[model samples]
Target: MIDEHATPDLLELAARYGVSREFVDWRGRLTTVSASTLIAVLRALDVDASTPDAIRSALGDTELAPWRRPLPASIVQRAGDTPWIFVHLPHGAQFRAWAVLEDGSTRDIPQIDNWIDPREVDGVLTGRATIVVPADMPRGWHELFVAITDDGATERIARCPLITVPERLNTAAANDETKRFGIMAQSYQLRSNTSWGIGDTRDLGALASWGARQGASFVLVNPLHAPAPVEPIEPSPYLPTSRRFRDPLVLHLDVIPAVQLLEGPDAERFATLSRRATALNATPTIDRDVVWRAKREGLELLFDYDLKDPVRKRAFGMFCEREGQELVDFATYCALAEEFGADWRAWPQALHDVSGQAVSEFRDTRADRVEFWRWVQWLTEEQLLEVQRSACEAGMSLGIMHDLAVGVHPYGADSWAMPEALARGVSVGAPPDMFNQLGQNWSQPPWRPDRLAELGYKPYRDMLRAALRCGGALRIDHILGLFRLWWIPEGQTPDAGCYVRYDVEAMLGILALEAERAGALVVGEDMGVVPPETRDTLAHFNIDGTSVLWFERGMSDEPLAPEHYRAHALASVTTHDLPPTAGYLKLDHVRLRHELGLLEVALEDEIQRERATIEEVLDTLRARGALASAASSVEEHTLALHRYLASSSARLMGVSLADLAGDTRSVNQPGTHREYPNWCVPLGNGSGERVTLEQVIASEWAVTLLEASRR
Candidate 1:
């Protein structure tokens, strides 16, 4: 029986748009999306479903929208497979179809006869003709060109983007027989004596070198994506202003070549600023505003230094030319954010449109400021390249593995520059699960699936290219999002949202293609409320999935044995969302969640259940001889947990830098924002003392655990 709130027509329209009417929740209970929620979500996708007449009209348009287009806006296929496209034209009309390769070559596409009835539109007959693409076409971005004529006179011409991607990702480790381990850390949380407050690429280079000496294979860090250019920047890396560019705040000034140009008061001011920022390392929390202000001032001084060398100028020109208009657009957004507030919506109406005359005039008038931002990105990228080089030189099989966040802030640069690519009036989040009973609203806008296809997934491709350019591997956060996202309507609670599906094949294909181009590895974060077939698909594409020690369970809800762990996974004992191994041993997650009012049940009961799960895992570890029966110390338990992970068939094992340093606090909490000071927490030892990267390298616990994992 159907709910009274949703009419049959409304349900049909929602289904046509890939919106779910009912789905199983995390708790294995069936939940129906309300009609009001459906209408709001449908409105977000630019469909009208508020009234019966609107639903009927949308249903009709949905049926004919494909027929109206001569060819679909885009076509994506595997490199080795032939893809067919349907072209619509006046009944019995003649047309020529061909593909223009990315290298400027052309190929004739032959037509195939597939039986389909003709439809009349506006008293004119229309037929759909199938055309076959050559399987031997080069794997790159190309275009399908169609010409329709009447009596040899060209009537219409249309073009569609053709993306030929790899059948499987390039993962060297997938074929290697050896098991490798790496250090996972939040890039900003890592501090060193040389860093000005927050961690820099230089710190990452040092950490990677040290880890390599300890027989590590890689260093996985948090997203280095840019935040708002203004003060009071959003602290969470997952909520970046733009995912397509790196944040300049992480640039280490001392190592930058431009810093050598400063003299007199400018040099003295830079030194004083650097000292003040370095003093921030002694504190327990990261003041990002103070850090950015100091870094921005230092960057401006460097930007002001004149470049008299022709070679340097040419290098800068080459970078700008290579980046092209996308870099220009991002830089322009940064400059405008400085003048107007960070939120583009609050800016003058004319400036809101990134391509409009007003914004163009603004860019022309404030060209210097825009250039300054662009130069900063170039500098940041230069340092990033050095860090990766150092990692590889240190003998890392996979160097710095960058993380890709799931979405972007609704009011940030990406949304401002490409408004059509993002959906309006809705945010991305998760429904209720075992840990987060109340659900979560991330406040980040979901990508518009339809628009992304129409635009040929350029935005997505650009982001992946930038992320993989200098890294050996990339970890996609919340990779489940590629298949479907939970869409929460504006002003609605997260539980009221419904799932919206995407073109998963296209998304995964493009990701694999980019990774293949860069010769990098891909690890998908496939945790939390995942569909059963999602992991299979990831493995089919040679993309590794994430597996945590505490979450692995068997049919009886007991901890899984080491041999049962997935081989194509990045196995870890702990994650950033949870406390380090030492803290988890003390039941910190349960206690903290209880204190934050994030628990639906009684705190004691939750703690009891958690303790029971921990005991079961410990028992398994002891039975496997990974832990001694008499081992009761936190350090012993932590080491034993990792030793257990080392025994797994998992191709890659990730050791958290926090755990290695004996850190007891979590770098992030899942549900709460301001209540817990989430991403601001600095790296510390068990005694809660702030430690620099140099000190962490010399830490006894870190050394011992790393050695144990290697053995």
Candidate 2:
């Protein structure tokens, strides 16, 4: 099955290395090789492998020139396909491989030569095949050619254009222009007057408006991504039911036209609910269930009144047309989840398959349910767009950057819609890093990278397009996943997870292309265990990285200066994971971390040290004549941090609204779920009353920070 001319003679190489052909086969299949094995291969090839450093030195000094090849046509494999062909070549060299069809047209294919298997080689010269064609190519005379060109020197090595037409199209070309950012209002305390129960779309719109006014080009909100169908829902935005749809709980039910149509006692009940919603908005803590319930009830009444308004129906039709089968499958998953208690596995066998007859019948019989779900998406999109409009009107440059979660819930709508895309038996998470030694199992299903690639990365491309549609930018949570992800097998601890690689070239390329089309910028969440190369790669693409204040300490044991910050980074004093500025100053952050078992050292000592450091920095500012107008109070100090961030060399700066209002609690506490009230707090005053957007701007501290930064 192997082409002799296109591959290295494995038996010959095996003999040269004094290793059997079987051993070579094993090495090719092994994902990770030991240092000894690596050394043996190097030594067998007459290369230095005495020590690890020696091996590196020898390879670095080789000075071998790169091999070049001609462009190849795109080839894709799908389910039930056989004989996958891979062209191998050296890394850091430009080679093109294109297929010549019957019409004499050429199509480009992806090239990767950094690593190759000796036994299964197809496209190689000397020890490698320059190109390989699948054995399943049609029984016709075809010519496949591989040209090696380096520094303008061209050499034709092999030629084959006889491959059969694959079932799918390959669309893995990389684009380098998309920028992303994140928003965190849900963590902020809610003000009562404008929000319903917690901070709803109205507040989100106002925040977007504020962001735009601050000269931000775009504002990225957390996954407005929908959650599971069942009650007592997971509050984490990362664990979403459907990445394609928005959460209904965030709907501004009061703004809907049907609310005005309520009559008599119905109107009174609606008024009472509105009043309660307004009251709840004043509360410090966000009651998600309560808000969801209120909104659901209100929506039910609205749905009953105007089940199919012309505009709403048209909007639904548009969504259906835009999303196509993906939306249909997602809505079906939601309906099925609702009936089967959120677990598709627990549902009847007929409903298990999205394309099954049961689903088709359900769609026909329960058309209203499907239409209602679609309507919810339409309204959600409308509200988000309105937020964007408000931001643009407010004179913000970028405005409304949205956050894209890393993965979808295991049993959520996305998994149901694209079961083949997700690894049903494994989950996505982080390996043990400096921050969390125990590691983290996010409990969200990850896409099967191989499957996604085979399908030409349609799912990923669609997602990026959707996210960039409404926002000026997008913040990819765990942005490293675009390159590699730690995959934990089912029933295993997170520590048992192993790093699975991804097509970084395709990922970044698609992102850049989409962002260029959408006129947006990209920001990667490169916090925690980010490799140095990741930063370098992101910088190469003009994608901004994140810089948080607490983590900006230098190796020299000195604080990082604002001027030292990279211009291609988004600088902020704190993030949703850290304590708000006010809470940090009050030492509440120290106590909270201690209580949550996150603190390893003495809490008092840590707090005192941190406080001293802050004071020392303030003193430095005073000495430099930069603190003369700085605020003296804790709230004022918080404002000063914003001013510092704003004045930093970084191109963009983010001010958490929680800090603006002096809210103490963090929006999320990483490890603990039930133990900590993560994602439950609203933006509000210390007394638990939800603060309105006006209140936030009116606050003396907010005004002080905003004005000080201007000076």
- Runs in model 1 with CA error above 4 Å? 1-4, 171-174
Superposition error at 491 for model 2 (Å): 3.7
Q: Highest lDDT: which candidate?
A: 1
Give model 2's clash tally.
73
Model 2 over residues 78-173: C-alpha lDDT tens digits?
A: 213343344434433445565555456554443443355333122444223444444444322234555555446565464533324222212211
lDDT of 1 by residue, 135-200 (tens): 888788999998997566656889999999888885564455578999999988889988889999
Which structure among the candidates has the greatest TM-score?
A: 1
Error of 2 at 222 (Å): 2.1
Worst 10 residues of 1 by lDDT: 304-313
lDDT, residue 695, model 2: 83
Q: Which stretches of candidate 2 lie over 4 Å from their true place?
A: 1-184, 187-191, 210-218, 260-269, 282-284, 304-308, 432-437, 608-623, 628-632, 686-690
Candidate 1: clashing pairs of residues: none
